[model samples]
Target chain A: MKTYIAKRLLGAIPTLIFISMIVFVVIQLPPGDIVTSPLDRMQSQGVELSSEAIQNLRAQYNLDQPLPLQYLSWITNFVTGDMGYSYLFNRPVNELVGERIGYTLLITLSALLFTWAVAIPAGVYSAVRQYSLGDYALTTVMLVGLATPSFLLALIVMYFGYEWFGISIGGLFSPEYRDAPWSLARAGDFLSHLWIPMVVVGLGGTASTMRILRANLLDELNKPYVITARAKGVKPLKLLVKYPLRIAINPFISTIGFLLPTLISGEAIVSIVLNLPTTGPALVQALINQDMYLAGSFLMLLTILTIVGMLISDLLLAWADPRIRYE
Target chain B: MSELKSQDAIESDNILQVRNLAVEFHTETGRTKALQGVSFDVPRGQVTAIIGESGSGKSVTASAIMRLIQPPGRVTAGSIDFAPSGSEPYDVLALVDKDSRLEQLRGDHISMVFQEPMTALAPVYTVGNQVAEAILCHREVSKKVAWDEAANMLQRVGIDDLQRRMQQYPFEFSGGMRQRVVIAMALVCQPDLLICDEPTTALDVTIQAEILTLIRQLKGELNNSVLFITHDIGVVAQLADHVVVMQGGRVLEAGTVRQVLKQPMHPYSKGLMAAIPGLAPKGQRLATVASVVGATDITTAYPLTRLADGRQISLSPSQLKAFGHE
Candidate 1:
């Protein structure tokens, strides 16, 4: 097991490097550097703009360097404290991400935990009591949840919040603790409003996960081993948990690899609709502005998480399933 | 047209009495009457083999005894009066779903071993943990004690190196060995009635003989009644004290093994008996155990005779089914 983990870790190095390059190239794909848009804006607004100033701006951002050198420089500076300085925010790229990454983690992680905790039991119940009233109701509700896009749900929810409560349902707080530092009151305020975005982001995931689990568990419940366990006098709940659920949750656990990048990036459209201050919005802005290091670093973070998440899930599967031997 | 034995024929010491056991499978296609009015007695400390071909509802009958039949397949009508030796008789069919009484009855008063060892045990768990879990479910013992008892049971089943073998998963063991572990688990609780559902049909001949011998030995040691379900006449010959021949979910004839094997009264029973190779069709298989095993392998490997064999030139679909190919 240790060797297997070590081998996986070693193999991920090249994949991370490869992903890093793709993120860099893709972020760099749009013609012109960060100066292009600003220069255009300044020119169109009938303001005086200088060629030497443009040359200095280009030199400052290393736009004149070769692509590989630029990549190396960006990566190196990123390894240090620089991160190619975000001109839009007038802050370092790392600091910008660090500020918003907390909210991003909080929203996604909470939603993830909530989704699994609810999905598994709901799915198990649906399968165990298949074709019953409760099963049908849950199936119908989850189908609706799956079919409606999260942004639309968020919009409807926001509208309902405004109409019913006479208050805006946007952002992480009630505007009083917008820039407040860590404190019990601020934390409470944030949490009081946490559920909306979490629900909006999590509904689709929860619905899909529940359906998968239900199908997997349904297939496993018919397996001969379940009958053997039943023959052993194992009660319904214990038997389901012990025999079929253990095998059924394989696909769910394997989804960890897919979740890290997705959740960390945040749901872009949903975040926009809910007006949550998460890194998801910043990612798109950074790429569009050609904030090379900022965008590349964000991608790098996702890339690292994705590969590491895969490793963790693979190890977990190897541990849980005796049949899946890593060696 | 010989019929199933009447209730009067059931010995007083019978461990389980099943009557009018009718199972139905409700599917999208339609409802299938898998078993209808299947009556039998599992005499105490004796092996009663219910023999039939595939889809003969023999397995359905065994599962119905434990009420282990899954959804889509249910025991729609039946009364299995289980009167374990030294215990009061109870109407098994009266127990509702998830009833504690039924739970206690399983693994304590009754247990079951299945046909294929390949899928009989959960793959994730160690054999020892599984057996120990079975013990723990019914017994009021500590984990240590349950595990120790599991090890002892494995040893009892002729498995040497019990400590090592118990820690291993099902995939690590051969089919016969896994079956041994399964038997060990079933007998570990020392249930009065143990259902063996085609237990040796999936095994090779030598392993089959060994497993049969082991089952008999364990049955002797445990002194529990066994309901052996199988299709092989040779297997029934070696293990059964009483024989019940079934076709199309109904028992055609049943009696003491001696009486039924010597003089089958029903025409279907006679045909089944004739299929035993040396009694009739020789080279076509079923004469010897090896021939029977080979024949089953052939049918399993090739459903249609794409083989340019002259023997199958005149074969019809019904004739093919008579050979049990479909």
Candidate 2:
């Protein structure tokens, strides 16, 4: 198993390099350099922008260096865990990126847990009561969840939050609670506003999982082994859970790789709609300003997350099924 | 005539009676006949083997008795009157639409052993848990008692280190051992009738013999009726008291193993007998029976004369002189 994991990690080097190159080239080809717009805007306002001032700004930000040298410096600093400085925010890119990683992880992890908790039982019940009213009702709800876009759902949820609770529909914390220490009161304030984005992202994802799990369970139910269980006179519910669900859920678990990307992308849209201070909006702003350091750091982090999610899925698959051998 | 009467009397003495049983499958193309009008009786304490080739509907016949046929297939016609001697005979076909009645009969009175041992047993579950499941399904027993009974059943089926083996999954066992586990599960409830469908086909010959012998021993010990299905005549010869030969969804011939083996009457039966390798000489070409031959021609060809009263009078080639056929 160690050898297998080592091999997999070794194989990932080229992949990471490829992702880095794509991110670097795409970010460079854009319309303006980081300081061009702000400098031009300041000059157009009748503020005298001298060549000495512009060159000083360029030298301070490393914009005066050649493109290859800038890329190499970025890579060297990145490998050493120094993400350099943010040109747009005028701070260390690491500090800026680190501040939001916690919030994103909280939302993503909570949504994943919520999705499985609801979707698995729903899928099992739907399969057991197939073609019954319960099955029909669950299926219809799943279809609705699938067809509705998460962003649209997020907006509707925000509107409902404003109308029903009389609470502010945007931002992660209340005005008075902002900048306060982490306590139950602040946490409660955070959670009250957290539900909308969570549901908006989670429910959309749960719908697909429910459908996949239901189909997998239905397929397992038809296998001869299930018939053998029934023939053994096993009670209907026990047989459904023990034989059908246990074997069927493996495929759904392996799909975690595909699901993580959805969660990341969906969180971005949710964070934007709800005005939560997360990496998504920050990454977007960085790209628009051509802040190479902040943008590259965020892209690399996303790439690492995608790779980790896939690895977890593979390990989970091996654990869930005894027939699978890493060697 | 006396044999028929005795067979009828044995029906009252037996556990399950299947009379004129037929099953058909409704396909997208049309309703394909799976089992034609077939009739046989499983005696109280003996094995009755139903031997046939693939697609000859032997499995369908067993599935029909259990009333487990799925959509696109059903018990289209005929009756499966299961008379557990001294009790009222319940019509299996009548229970086709009544799930409660079928559920009541299944696992409690009629249990089945499927063909593929590996696929027949749930892969995720331990062998003992699966066995205990059968006992718990019919009886309102506690987990401890059910598990104990399952362990006992495993021992009865000749599994050593029963406690250890019980905890292992189906994949951990060899092909022969898996079949034994399956048999233990089926017989754990000690149902009156055990339906085995090609139970030994997936096993190697040595293991096949062991499984067949184990089944025979278990049937003897339990004194239960077995409806054994197989295409191997050799297996049928080893296990059956009576043999029913089937082909193309029809019963071509049925009689005592001695009668079927020594003197097969139907053309299909003759073909099957002739096709048994090593039974005939290597150089000599065995006579192949024609396709259109029927039961009426069988009587004349074999010269097993039937009396006016419908008694089958056996006449050998040398005994033909007595009937003045020579």
Candidate 3:
């Protein structure tokens, strides 16, 4: 297992390098550079800037270098932990991302837990009691949850949280706890406001997850081995779990590669509506304003997460199923 | 005919007595009777083979006895009285809660070997785990004890390499080996009655003969009754002590294998026996059940046949006299 992980980690180097190049090229694709956008904004603000000043700004930002040279320097600095300066935020990209990544992970992880906790059982139940009343009802509700746009759900949840419950549901913390240092009370406040975006984001995933699991499990429920288990006098629930459910969960584990990127860059629209401080909104803002270093860094982090996620999923699948071997 | 056999004899000699068994399947279109008034006796320490063509309720009878008929298919009517060794006879259909008493009966008193051995064992589990699970499901034994018994059972079923083979999954084994594992699982608990639903049907012809021999050898040593379901008359000739012939969910003829084979009373049974491939000369049109048994009557004459060598022969009057019928 250790050797497999080592091999996978080594293999990810080329993939990460390739993704970094794509991220750079995509960030550079919007017809204007970081210097051009902000300088144009400055000119529109009636600030008098000479051509030499523009040239100096371009040189300072390394925009005057050849594309490959700029990529080499940017990648080298990124590899060495220097994420470059974000002209829009007027701060280093590292510091800008560091402040929000924790909160983003906290929400995403909890929402993921919520998704599996709810989806797996619901999926199993729906499959076991397929065509029953509870199955029909659960399917209807999950379908509605899937169809309703997450941002719209977030707005509705926020409205209800404020109107009915009299709780401020927007953002990660209350007014008092927004800038307060870490404390139990502040943590409690943070949790109190985390559920809005968590549910809004998690519900959609839960719906799809339940459907996939239900379909997979339904296929397995009647397989010969399941009947063999049943004939062995295994209790119904035990038989379901040990035989069919074990096989049914394979697809779920295989999908974990996509979850890592989702963890860092959560539902952007939902985050924007809920006013939560997460990497999703930061990445979106950087992209819109063409903040090259910040946007490029965020995309690179997502790319790395995807690779790491795939590795983790492969390891997990190998662990869960004996048939899956990595040699 | 079963009524003529004294109840006392059946009570003492039979492990399972299925009487007036009826099963129905309710699908979207309408209801279909899968088994109707089907009855048979699996005498103790003997193989009772239910012979029928496909859809003849042979498997349904086995499933009904095991209480394995699921939704849309139900035991609509019947009394399946199973009298396992040293246990009081009880009506299997009378068990109200399918989970409690029925659970104890299955894999404990009565175990089943299904038709498709390739798919019968769970692929995700090791051969030992699946076999041991049968022991553990009934008896409250330590995992080690159950596993050891599983290994022993696997060895008994002709599987070698106790350490390596037990740990291997079903996919690693060939079809014949997997069926052996399945048999080991069913017999691990020393079930009084092993319901084999075409256990050898999915295997190759050579493997099928070996499995049949294994089943008989095990039955003799273990002193357990086997309720074997199959459409193969050849298999019946090899293994069965008593034979029950069925057609369209109803029993047509049932008697000792010698009686059923030598002097089949039912035209359907005659038709079935005549339909055996090798019975007809090579290159001749095989006699199907419909051909021997008239569409609306049982009095159809047995046809004369031209042999592969171009010679023709018919059942002589003396041969018909030996059958004691025209």
Candidate 4:
């Protein structure tokens, strides 16, 4: 197992590097730089625009350097655990990204747990009550979840929140609690705003997960071992839980690789509709303003997240299924 | 007919009495009749072999007795009466609506060993856990006690290193070893009647002989009645005291092994006897006895005779009839 983990860690190096290169190139290929947008806004404020001032600004931010040299310096700093300053926010990139990573992980993980907890039981019940009215009802609900897009769901949730409870959707925390210290109260306040996005993002994913788990459960239920269990006079519920559920859940756990990426993209849409101060909107804003460093860092973070999710899923697969050999 | 003795004096008391049992499968195309008017008695403390070809309704008969048939297939008629030792006879067909009563009988009074041991045992659980699960289902024993009983059962089935084998999964064992594990599980509760459905057909010849020997030894030790199902007449000769030969869901002939093998009355039974390899020597060119049985249309240049006792008999020209040629 140690050897297997070492091999996996070794394999991740080239993947991270390749991802970094693509993020770097794609963020730089845009038409405008970060300074251009801010400078245009400043000019509208009747400030005198001077070429020398622009040059000084560019030099201070290291934007005047060649793209290759800039990338080399950025890569070296990234490897050393030092993400440079964000040109748009005028703050250290690590601190800015770190604050948002917590929020992203909070919503994503909650949504993941919610999806599994809801889908597994529903899927199994649907399979057990196959062709019955209960099964038909669950199938109808799953179809509705699939038909309604996440963005539209988020919009509907936001409208309901606003009308029913008079809640604000401008950001994750209320205005009074925005800069509060990280405590349970502040965290609870933050989570109140997180519920809508989590539900919206989790609905579509839960439907797909239910469909997959239902198919898997049905297949395992038909296996001869299950029949053997029944012939042993095992109770139907115990047979379903102890034998079929364990084998069937392994395949769904391995599907976490695809599920994680879907969650991230779904979060992006949810954040946009609800105006949460999450990485989704931040990444979009950086791209639109051509903030190469910020955009590249965010993209790299997403790529790293994807790789980590896949690695975790593989490890989980090995843990859940003893038949799988990592070698 | 007087020459054929009833042999009721040698027959053990009946344990299970199945009468007019029929099974039908309700498929999308239509209902398919799988079993038709199958009636037989499984005697106590004796082995009764049900011999037939594939799709001859032998397995279906055993499954119906256990009440294990799934949806789209059901026992449509008749009764399966179970009379346990010192207990009143209860009709199993009447308990279809009362599941608790049926549940009380299965795994405690009756247990079954299926074909293909590789699939009969769960792949994910340890062999010990699977057996313990079976024991605990019918008994109120603690887990530890159940597990110890399971280990003992494994030892009884001739598995060496019982402790180690108990911890292993089904895939870790060979076909013969897996069947032994299955036998251990089936006999753990000391069921009054054990149903084995072609238990050795999936095994190689050597393993098949060993399994048959193991079953015979176990049957002697337990003195429990066994309803063994198989198509191999050789296995029947080695294991069964009494045999019922079935064709197209009907009992073609039934008698003791000696009576059935040496003096088969049914034409289908004679055909089956003639088909057995080595019954006739190589290059002697065994006579094809296809005309007596109408299911297959193979032509034969021979005649079938109606004996004075009214049983149809067919004989090969090379063989002399000890009894007058029907």
Candidate 5:
């Protein structure tokens, strides 16, 4: 098992390197350089730097170099822990990400947890009671959840939240606790305000998971083994959970490979509406202004997370099912 | 003619009695009567084999005994009276609303081995766990005791290396070995009535022989009555003391194995006998089942094709003499 995991991790290095190249090219795809974009924003703010100084800034940031050479330098520096500057925020790219990373990680994890908790049981119920009134009701609700725009939902929720309860409808904490240091009270306040974004983001994912699980489980329930188990006199509930369910959950587990990486920058628009200080907005801003190192680093992290998530889920699947063989 | 019967005549000394059992399948096309007034009996501590071709209600009879028939197919009429050892006879069909009572009987007092033995064992669970689960489901025993019995059952089924083999998954075992595991699972609870639903049909000849021998040995040791469901007349001959032959959801003839095989009364039963390959003479074309039975409107699919020369496809007198037919 250790050897299999080691081989998997080793294999992932090349995959991440390939993804980094794609992330670099794609981040650079939009027309406009870091210097020109920041220069345009600065002019809009009624503060302008001369064109010579602009050219000087490009030279300083190595924007004057060829793309390949620049990528090479950026990658080397990144490997050595020197994530470059972001002219958009006038701060170090690493610092900008660092400030919001904690909140982003917390919310995304919570949202994912909520999604699985709600979706798996709902799917099982829907499948077991397929075509029943309850199944149809759940199907309609899931369709609505999937089709609704999350940003619009977030806006409506935020408006109702403030109007109804006088609770602060945006951000991770109340005004006084926003800048507070680590404390149980502050943690409690954070949680109190955390659920809004979690729900708004998790709702669509919950619907998607329900659909996948319901379909997979329905297919599994019809297999001969289910009948065999039933004939063994296994009770209805235990039979459903143990025999077919164990196999049905494989597809859902494989989804974990793609799910974790998306968490880093998912819900960008929803986060914007809720005014949550998360890296979702930062990654979007970095891509827009061509903040190459910041955007590349975030994208690289997403790629690494994808590789890591796939490895973890593969190991989990192997553990859950003895049929899977790494060798 | 001595086996002339209705529901009540089948009750005495029988471990299982199915009386006018009717199952209908309701689908979008329409309701089709799958089992029409099907009645049979399994005598105590003996193998009573139900033989029929596909869709002849052979499997439905097994399912009805265990009450495992699913939706769209329901037993609309019947009283399956099960007189399990040490218990009074009760209507098996009446336990439909009493799932707890049925659960107590199924896999505990009555267990079954299905045709697809590889698919019968749950893929993810260990062979030992799958077997032990049957014991634990109906008995109030510790995990260790249940597993010990499970291992013993496997040993009785002739599987060697109990410890390591118990830990292995279904895919790790061969088809014959898997069937043994399936049998071990069914018998671990020491059920009063064992249902074999074409258990050897999926196996190759040598493996099938091995499985048949194993079942005979195990059934004698446990002293359990078996409702052996199969289409193979050869298999019925090997194991059954009595036999019931069915066609088109109705019983054509049922009596002792000697009476049914040697003196088959119905045209369908006679056709089934003639269809067995080795009984026909060499260098003479064997009659297709449709021609042998004089295929009825309901059984048209049995006709392989029509031959212009009926005399060319006739069975020889010597083979007919061996089969105890005129």
Candidate 6:
């Protein structure tokens, strides 16, 4: 098992390197470098600059070098934990991401837990009572949850939240705690406003997960093994849970491969719309401004997390099912 | 004929008694009767095989006995009386509303082995866990005791390498080995009555004989009654002491293995016996029930043969003679 995990981690190195190259290339694909917009603003302001001054400006941002040399410098700096600078925020990329990483994880992890807690039981109930009034009711509600656009739902919820509940739904904290240092009241304020984005992002995942689980459980409930378990005098609920549910929940474990990266990346559109301080909004801004270091770092981190998540899910699946484990 | 006893012999000699049992499936199309007034008795300490082709209600009868018919299909009418040893005799149908009681009776006193051994065992759990779960469900033993018992049961069912095999999953084993594991699970609780619903139907011919022999040996050693359901007459002949021949959800003939297989009084039963490929002379075409009975739908073609006059009626002596029962 140790060797297997080591091999998986080793195999991920090449993928991470490949993705790093792609992130660099894609960032460079934009027509203008980060210097273009600032230079354009200066020229529009009617400031006269000689060719020598422009050369110095390009050298300051390391844009005057060969592409490969610039790539090597940026990559070496990135590897050594110096993630270069972000032209968009005009701050070091590390400090910018450091400020937002905690909030990003907090919301995503809680939303994931919420999704599982709600969806798994609802799915089991729906499948066990299939076609009953409760099943139909749950199915309709979850389908609506699945079909509606999340950002739209976030907007609607925000409107109603402010209108009826007198609670401001945007951002994760009140104005008083927005820039405040960590304290009980600030933490409390942060949590009080966290659910809006959590629900908006997690509802869709919960709906799809519930539906998948229902289908998987329904298929397994009729399998001959389930009948064998039932004939063994296992109580209906216990038998359902122990035998088929064990198999049905496998895909849910594998979904962790996607979920782990979201812990860092957050939900891009929802975070932007809600104005949450998360890496997603930061990455989007960096891409728009062509801030290669910040954007490339974000992409690289996401790639690493994805590989780790897939490995974790594979290990978990193997642990849960011996067939996969021994194979 | 000598096995015939009075109705008062219910709890004394028989382990299961089904009376006027009816099951129907209510679907969007219509309600289709799966079992229509089916009645039979499974004598204690012996194998009683229910024989019929597909849709003959052989499996339905087994499910009804275990009260395992799922939704859209329900036992519309039936009284399945179970007289398991060391338990109070009760009508199995009456326990439908009493879930815990029914569950207690199901795996503890009466267990069922299904067809398709390939799918009969849970895939994710280890063989030992599944077999031990069966014991744990009913008995108050610790996990260690249950595991030990499970290992012993596996050994008895002809599975070797107790140490490694117990830790392995169902997918790791062959179909025959998996069937043995399933049998070990069914017998771990030491059930009074074991219902095998075509347990060997999914196995190859050689494996089928091996499984049949294993079941026979286990029944003798364990001293439990078996209600075997199969479509193969050869399987019935090899394992069953008493036989119930069914067609179209109804019983056509039921008696001792010899009485039913040798001198079948009903045209349908005779046709079924004659349909056995091995029973036909070499190079001769195999006769089917439809052809021999001269009816496309034999279920409706013949009324059920009355067992009261079964002693006097004998038809198709040539088929019986071909069967080497003359």
* Residue A227 miss distance in model 6 (angstroms): 0.4
Query: Is candidate 1 or 3 superior in DockQ?
Result: 1
DockQ of 4: 0.48
lDDT (0 to 1) per candidate: 0.80, 0.79, 0.83, 0.80, 0.80, 0.82
Q: For every candidate structure, what is the RMSD over all alpha carbons to the true structure, in angstroms?
A: 7.8, 5.6, 5.5, 5.3, 5.8, 3.9
For residue B143, model 2's alpha carbon misses the true position, in angstroms, by: 5.0
Model 4: residues >4 Å from true position, as ranges?
Answer: A31-69, A182-187, A325-327, B1-12, B96-99, B284-292, B296-326
Candidate 6 per-residue lDDT over residues A146-202, each given as its tens digit: 898877888899899889999777898898889899899998887788888788877
Q: Clash pairs of candidate 4? A: none
Proportion of native contacts kept per candidate? 0.88, 0.51, 0.70, 0.44, 0.68, 0.89
Global local distance difference test of model 2: 0.79
Error of 2 at B47 (Å): 0.7
Candidate 6 CAPRI-style tier: medium
Please give the ranking of all candidate structures by DockQ, highest first, separated by commas.
6, 1, 3, 5, 4, 2
The alpha-carbon lDDT assigned to residue B302 of candidate 4 equals 24
Regions of candidate 6 where Cα sits further than 4 Å from its true position: A260-266, B1-11, B301-326
Per-residue lDDT over A201-248 for candidate 4, one digit per residue giving the tens place of the 0 to 100 score: 888888888888888888888686887677677887788888888898
User: Worst 10-residue stretch by lDDT in candidate 6 chain B?
Assistant: B1-10
Cα lDDT tens digits for candidate 5, A181-243: 979999899888889989988887888899889999989996877877777778888989898
The residue-by-residue lDDT of candidate 5 on B1-326, one tens digit each, is: 02223346336588887777889999999999898777667889999999988988899888878888888788899788888777777888887555676996788888889899778777888988888888878888999998999999889888899899999888989999999998988888888899999999899999999999988998989899998999888889989998888777876567789877887655677788888888888888886667786756234222111123110111234433454544
Give the distance in Å from residue B153's predicted Cα in candidate 5 to where it truly belongs. Answer: 1.1
Better of 4 and 5 by TM-score: 5
lDDT, candidate 2, B159-257, per-residue tens: 999868888878889989999988998999888889999999999999998999899999889988889999888888888887877766766566678
